[model samples]
Target: MASLLFYMSATVLFAQSTVAFNCSINPIYVDIHKRAVHGTDIFQYGSFIGVGTPAQNQSLWPSLSQNITSFASLSYCTNNSTTLKECTKSTGGFFDASTSDTFRELEDFNTLDNDRNGTFDGAYGRDNMHLYTHYFETDGASETRLTDVTIEIAQKGDIAPSIVGIGRESTVLDALYAQGLITGKTYALYIGHGFDRAKGAVNGSNVFGGYDSGRFTGEVHKYPMSPDTKNPMTVRVKDIIINDAAVPNGEVSLFDQAAFPDMKSTPTPFQAEITTDQYPLALPYQITQNFIKHLDAQKDNYWGDNSLKLKSQFNGSLSIVLDDGFTVTLPSEVLSNWSNITPIQDRDENSTSPNYLSTAFLGQIYLMADYEDHSFYLAEAVQKNNMVMPVSWCPKTGAPQAYQRPQQNAWIKQGLIGAVVGGILGGIGISVCAYCFIVAYLRKREEKKIEKDLERSKAAKIEQMEIEEAPEFEGPPKTPKTATPFFWKKRRS
Candidate 1:
């Protein structure tokens, strides 16, 4: 979710010992996408994919015809908020089939229909209509594709233009794995703290099959990735603490389920998932009200936008207790802050939901996910500008590989324990241990590689499987119909 289920680079210094993953990072842009006609065209808004073929709406973008990567003409669907009429103000864009030779349309439908809600909802409740399938891979990160991969084109109204899906089932990552572009099924992210003017222009990284160790410091807290891959990644939140004082568990829910009709109405201890897509730390209404009381914060308009703003004099930090016993304490700045809200479809621009909630969708925290082991690491982020970090792939744990036996390490074990106890070490003691750990790790790695190589050299002859002819891509039926909703127009809300 931190990678934008709907949703890193370079070798740099880390203040503490960290794990390096074998992943590749690419430079991505965030464009605001306003045309010159509005005189509001230049600022950038974050997007997973860069410029593609020109769309039908190319005329709207005065600069579209000049850009080489501009291949497809963007088409604007009818705005379903009021009437099913063509949208003139909507600025959303996507990869149009008429423009790209390698574009292959698969099926278009609501991907997040866990509750049979007849709508698509991200883990944090960001709703949109999606079209998914494979396409030719070019540009972006060189290591990203060895062949064609799947992509999800989102029509999220004005909230998000279009973003690449990095979820478990995303075929883009799958294509990378199937072609051996990456060693395993994994990706890493570093969502920076630059979503608003106060933080300024901040860039984050997205890596395939690994994570960059240089972006984070302190003891990394590793938690098992959720087995339910279809749903967004979720963690066990044991409790919430405000200023060293624990909040009553039954008093308020972790998130606002009212937006989700199928979900329970009562408060639950830990139902929240980690996400980089949503800005606020969304919470139940009751809990949010309670927190406001705790901060003794008064409501104020953010700029002239009149969005939810809190003027709090309290500066104490907030701590979250994970199911694994790891407690992460966030400073007041991150725990209590504001960002421009992504307006929802059919909702008043001035009345978009609260900016901060009990959801804990804070971007200041650093996270690392390992898809193979179905686990991820969490820690406070250490921000650096123009930073680039490389990833290293460690041997798989709890699972055996083609030429390697399953392996485990005390580093992870000790790291987990330390995180649980909040026993982060510093000074010479930590430095000495870090040195020893690196030395032992390198030695073990070299030894394993040599041993595996020797085994391959002495192995007997083996028979290879027969090759099969590739199947042709026959597009979906002209009138394919089913319970799953398909729309080139409006989302079935």
Candidate 2:
């Protein structure tokens, strides 16, 4: 009787373990919604997330520099704007602390600087955060909710969008992993070319704990995450090339002295951080000037963000070469459009500026970060299909591998065809051929079932075993007093 009871208890435990393991292994996918925000002429791409206890919905941009999720507080718009209409338009959406019953303020209103030229006055607090799979803010079919997640309510700051930070510190990803909602503390991003939806642009993808294999193409280049916690995702720019007719090869390197003899010095490879804070590829002043001169671009004073307007639209394409031999080419439309170009200011002979490969650059490549493994990968962006294959990055799995479709063996296909033809042509041994085919098919099916069962059994065993403690993540370093804060310059007219 004791042995029977033991067996029943073990079965119950195994069933519960399997259920928990399956839930943890599934990844959370957040789709980027293209909506007409008040300030911008072109449509913006952002994820619509719900915050607070009552679920105040807000369209927040995914920020790499920020450590916690931030919302424009009710005070921010009331103090900054003259009217309610302007407030809602400018702030994307605001959160009322009084309305949320679960909100608990941890820190009073204070100035917060993100080292990346982003200085804002905000109050730190803990609240319920919700991530939705649907693009619409109203819909909540498959929502992942976390209670008492750290958040910031911004009162006043530079013209910026409310952002959900996916940084190196204890971010939303970490919270999800800790709660066993996700398999690992990792995420992948594919900022689609959906800025102008009218012109065939599609919504971007932001997958937590895994990557959408269909979003990228070509060989994926891997790199170790930067030691600088402030800028974990950094890549070196080797050369900038433009398609030029006057040149012998119809391509001219911006760094080549022969091409631009007036250049004071030859530009060397420089590191740039990949961020989603803003659009435009922020390069060193020298490189920016070289690009401006080559393209005959002029400053758009109206924009007030150091945006360059092309005098005569450049018809040729522009290509950026990375240190790893990976190249990303931009079409003539991107080069001609003034809104797509911005120069890194305060960067000259003596001074240096924060070089960034911002949102615009992300539209052309796939970015995947494995915080646990301290590694990241980049691949050419592909939008050929909307197929999604989410690969889980469990603690046991370490790093999530990109999914590849299995190619069918030619021999198997040929053999099957030969068997069918032989059966039809020659009556002799027809029954034997049919029996063989049925046996092979049944064997393949049975093998698959066995493999799945084995995986489930292993997962249950792992769940039953004691889990090892993960290494502590290092905290962000203090921001320098002299460091300039970068702000989102987009504002309503």
Candidate 3:
């Protein structure tokens, strides 16, 4: 059971169903096991089914059930566009409400089910995991959307603070390996450090409070009455899976981008865009945009199209949030020209690819999806424009919708190279076969012709002999003299 559960969790943890046709083998499912390690010494865990979507105030996600269904119905293609079914209840994008206290950070996440209990487990061990579907997309009431999608990830692990990380440092991998227990074992990975305040980005409603140190004090400790300010569990996931779903389609174009309040600045690379009600990093501030200029990364906060529509421009006041929970804002004229990024590739290229960037410079990037309100990516950290988790994104501009093979002069040239090679091979094969057949046929025919010619010559020679003998026999004199000897008696008489 444990092994099965673990496999299931791993499958969901890293899922990408939008690429493959098989619903069972999707990579979009994010299954997390929020287990508690028995006590402070150990941990316990639980299983969860989740859509690979991020949550925040005023944030939205696609209908997990609907999208999954629609994906299942479609014939899977590496180059195709998939439209999610309308949320019958909402009949629109899934606008997920902020699970995080973006608008109001609880003095104690303890009351907030802090122990990674998933459900109200432990002190509030109701042992229940919450299920939510929130999405927000602007369609003509109902319209098709184009976002790269496929499969789902299912995975299981102690997605909690079980094996305490000995220390804090980026370069401590070697040291941790030195500690056989730490290196040999594995763990789940969680991002976000607690803060005192939480609130929104527009006015300020995004913030949370917790100890600066990575410890789960609020939920895991014996003290329930205390706030949920415990350090976080550093989890290292075991497996990751994704389905490639980069269909061939024309991409969305960009028109304009502007922040309501024009600020004198450029789109900072690796910058964080925060939006909270009243707290630290709530307002859109220009931190460094760590994302690179031409590389693929998560939450790459650039002034590109947020609305995933063809010929549409991203006009929302959307900002980028970082993994550490920072945000980056866009000025009206900060971003222009959408040729920086290529078309959206398959899921694996966006997720597990070595070039895949880390967490968005901001906590999460803000982009647009079709029927889906917002799509998010939990990219790696320290990636310059590398790691990004967009609240939503589409290939409206810089990001293309399909892989672009270089333009050729004509259709014939499209696969000219391959065709040429194939033609050469075919010609050789035909020539060899024809040569052998013709050689055999000619050899037989030559023998028959030679026989006929020899017969004709022999007939001519025999005819000549008969004609020459007839001419010698034509003279009559030689026959009588020899015969007279027999009549000597008559002559004497």
Candidate 4:
């Protein structure tokens, strides 16, 4: 029999400021060799979370569910823009709300007003749904469950269906905080590679109020979270160093066109968000091309369909310099997905449209997010053969202090040669630096404007539903796409 771990009282003096509980990261199934009939990638991956009675008995929507057991991420009813059957069918999961005694309906709000009519669409087409469970648990340990233990359904949009709603305002996390189920609004993530284990199971880690230090090497590199609450995990990258060369040069443009035509080079000092939902780190084509060339990596095409991929048998590291003078270096093992060539169709059945397949997964990157103080920390991962639970983070202060390193100053000092600089150096040197900064700023600004324009233009078209109208299925209804529905929303970028 499994034992339940109760929450600690407020008066209890924890050894650490943050609390960490082992997470259950279930690997959904995928067929990497054959493409789906819906023009999706040959393979797709999603995480599994417990819902309904007997926790592990049912999986979440958009995940790989077997035995006809799973909960719908989005819910809906008759007379909606998308039929209930259509919504559930699209996600490739099995869900039946009518039979479950614990089923509860709520509003459905998707990533965007997918349809440009100034209205919102439910998950795929289904509205929000929740169920009661004896607290959430992964493996054997009990997880922090929100009120009603609800799970929002999402059948349509840019996000992967297998994700847990861990965003700043996600009702699930909010409820946990309101109920005093956690020490603070903090969490850590360690997404293990899917192909690493002999059984081919994912062993990723997620802890709600603290982190497990055993998952990372060296020390944590603390940085201020982005002030933009909408994009809290944003990181301002100063430059991308491949191996040892700062790429984006005219020479690297050759490989840029190999993946797609006119692959623009990404300028330095740009912003990127850390998204666990994606597998690849999203980089501009030009940078990707440079990454390919320097690493001697080749594009994969198992079916000879001119598939875009990053392939390399060699080893290398990609370093990201932040504006705050911190550096994050990722090993080739963490960045390479060459062996896995799953490509998801992003828009309008145009197989080559930009999508999650393009973004690089933060594999082996350990992350610590403190939502209460609006800060997060990151570190290079160190994989362990066995799980080790350290003492829970306990701090006497109101908020846990950030990590400090004695070598950080040395690293920044060496980086002063050409990296992020914001001071008055020798007269001529300062003048040249100022000139370069101005040019880079203007170029980055132009790119931002272009990206925004493209996003708006694409949002309308990509929001269209491909489901058959009045489709009949032996299951619950679809989430209503009404003019006004209040529910959870997240920015995936």
Candidate 5:
């Protein structure tokens, strides 16, 4: 009996597990706040996280390459001759070890360059971290807290601000998975265009363990993670084309040798890393030169070596075709406007120049990374939608399919239809069973009646035979005959 009870309990638990798996898998959606970072004119999208014992909120950028989360220290601003408010505005917020009792320094000040830009002096430590879904939450009700998380306090550096690394390492995603806040070690990002809320700029979002399907459009291309673990999300560019009235087909490839004969060499397909640490699309020197010549652009000494300004007006869209046949086209406004200048830059024709697609590229495409599977996906970004559909990756299948919501009345209608159909089928089955049972019972009753008649007929025949075999004499004569037969029988014996 105990074993039977155990089996029954197991069956119930299995059914519950099945139901949970088929239901919607909710992912953690980290919404980005649109505002300008300190010391920069361009409006940036960042998430607000709390740190320390009392939960001092800090705005931090999501780094795709770095694993360790770092925040600018209060000393960093003083060293740079900046005030606390300005520093706070610039670097999200500064970390003050003196204020937090839980802060523990793990390593002394040392130079670190994890961002690949340059080196900075900082101390490694552990502290409490808080992540929230909304920016305006002050009550800490929605906070997801982590204890003794590895963090950095940047004492001196030219680093922009605090950054939460979501790379393939022991990062926050791993911590979230460990805490059961998310299902898997996966995340998706879509950096929408324009930061000015007054000018109709849409905000972007970062999701953990899932993706927002409404933020992207078209077919998604899946790419295997590069064996080079440091730069796993690398893509190859096939060609760069732009719309030009001067060209025969109303468009021209930047790689066209005849059109730009002065290029250093024939342009070919090349690999580039996708990163969020910078904002320019770094390309080969030859391709950058081709763009410069076609657009009648001149170097902007004020901006930097790679920055350029238009010498002649050109209204044409720039399209980048990937080796996988996915094309992302940049509108003319993104190419022409001064605010959006320097979208493309040269990766100096040298051995050390790294070819990469920077944060600007992410502004046009949606990126989803699944570290557990060592794969990533890319799709064209959409800016106008307000839909916030977050879908999870199936733990068993490793597929991130969105949970499609049926129409408002669909479930009810389907349920009613199913009930009516099932009822009709059930009724037909029951009636057929009843008819067969009634026919069988009647046949059984008829068989029993035939048996009774046979028994009665046999008994009547026996009685009739007995009557016929009786002696022909009357009652008085039969007694004398019986006595004579008895005496003869005794003598014979």
Candidate 6:
């Protein structure tokens, strides 16, 4: 049976309009383990959260953003020819027919399995358009934090997925920009979520290479004001969220040093009595869909007043079958054009006392709202960093406190000035040259047009002359032939 699920987002400009969301059933669920509060749990809503009434319906981005704000379908987009479609009669997921192996078979076996098994209400041909959650937040008037913060995977079925879930991963700002996600440059949120809590330094285990030399801190987030500020420690970083991508138990940052002096770093030293606490999940999540929507605006179409509309299409869809038979359908994930992860170097690269050298994983994708915003994120950050470093990463959208917005009019005025200058130069050059060299060629075109017209005129005149001349020949048969009796005989051989 064929099924059609319609999704429409009617939104106004960011500043003038606020987004109010109401789905037939948007739900989200979060499950958290509290180490500090012992035996406690915290739940935050997510993806399926959009399916229900607005539990949290406040604009993360304001009115100026309203003009460009968007709600996108999250999933995978494929060439369709890249992977063959395999019809399934059971709970649906991406089943690679070529190898008959699932993504779960490749990684996160049990967790993946658990997610897959929970996805069906017994329909054979449900076009599962799964929703992948990305954390977004509006803090104060400056709206901040749009990143791959919390990534929850869900599908629409007879039942809805829960929205309460914790976020994961750091902000993906720079990568998003290069890929063109958000527009006008906004802040991004990086999230930290899992169990446990701390208010101080979190050291890493057995560090070898860092800015200050080979040091080891075995924790995450070590609060500077902690009682044991100097001692190695690991404080919980759950409240620190970058964007939509959350940092699960192991996804916290591999900081130059722990948030606390006693914080955590990845690759803990293999030793006894070296107190290596389990870290938050290492947040390395990427979206499966990149192309959100292609838009076009028509003026004066509505009420004869100025207004605009957007046209969008989902590239394609993907299937996810969790271990427990939870099948989720999603659109294709878009990819940032391949680029090198250039090193972040300070002015003292060759000097013994260099300023900053981040030990970050190379090639992390940062998603922005759009090209302009991406540029602003980088440009502003560069200025803020005082251009001291050659290159640095951009923060994601929705996290504005970290940045200062630019004046819009000044930028536009500069463009107008440049255009005027170009116009003047072009005009002057045209006046000086008069395109003299090509005068003959242009003249020739006119000449050809005239020549064709003249030829037609002459041809018509000649025809008229012929008609006038015809009367002379028709006047009388000059010297008419006389009848003569002459016998001719045919001789046959």
**Model 2 clash pairs?**
117-485, 117-486, 118-485, 118-486
Which pairs clash in the backbone of model 5?
A: none
Q: What is the lDDT for 467 in model 6?
A: 28
Which residue ranges in model 5 land beyond 4 Å of their true spot? 1-25, 35-44, 80-89, 108-115, 135-141, 194-200, 301-305, 394-399, 402-493
In model 1, the worst 10-residue window by lDDT is 59-68
List candidate 3 stretches off by more than 4 Å.
1-110, 113-435, 458-462, 465-493
Output the TM-score of candidate 5: 0.70
Encode model 1's per-residue lDDT on 152-183: one tens digit a residue: 33332333333344554554455556665565
Question: What residue runs in model 2 are displaced by over 4 Å at the alpha carbon?
Answer: 1-24, 35-44, 80-87, 108-113, 135-140, 196-200, 338-350, 395-493
Shift in Å, residue 431, candidate 5: 58
Per-prediction CA RMSD (Å): 37.2, 36.5, 22.5, 40.5, 21.6, 29.0
- Least accurate stretch of 10 residues (summed lDDT) in model 3? 203-212
lDDT of 4 at 16: 40
Tell me the spans in candidate 6 whose CA falls farther than 4 Å from its real position.
1-236, 239-386, 389-414, 435-493
lDDT per residue for candidate 5 within 44-64, as digits (tens), equals: 457757688977676677777
For model 1, give the RMSD to the true fold.
37.2
Better of 3 and 4 by lDDT: 4
lDDT of each: 0.41, 0.71, 0.23, 0.43, 0.71, 0.22
On residues 193-268, what C-alpha lDDT tens digit does candidate 3 reach at each position? 1111111121101100001111111111110111111211111111111111231231111111232123354333
Q: State each candidate's clash count.
A: 39, 4, 172, 32, 0, 175
**Pairing residues by index, what is the TM-score of model 3?**
0.24
TM-score for model 1?
A: 0.50
Residue-level error in angstroms, candidate 5, position 486: 99
The TM-scores, one per candidate, come to 0.50, 0.70, 0.24, 0.50, 0.70, 0.17
* Candidate 4 whole-model C-alpha lDDT, 0 to 1: 0.43
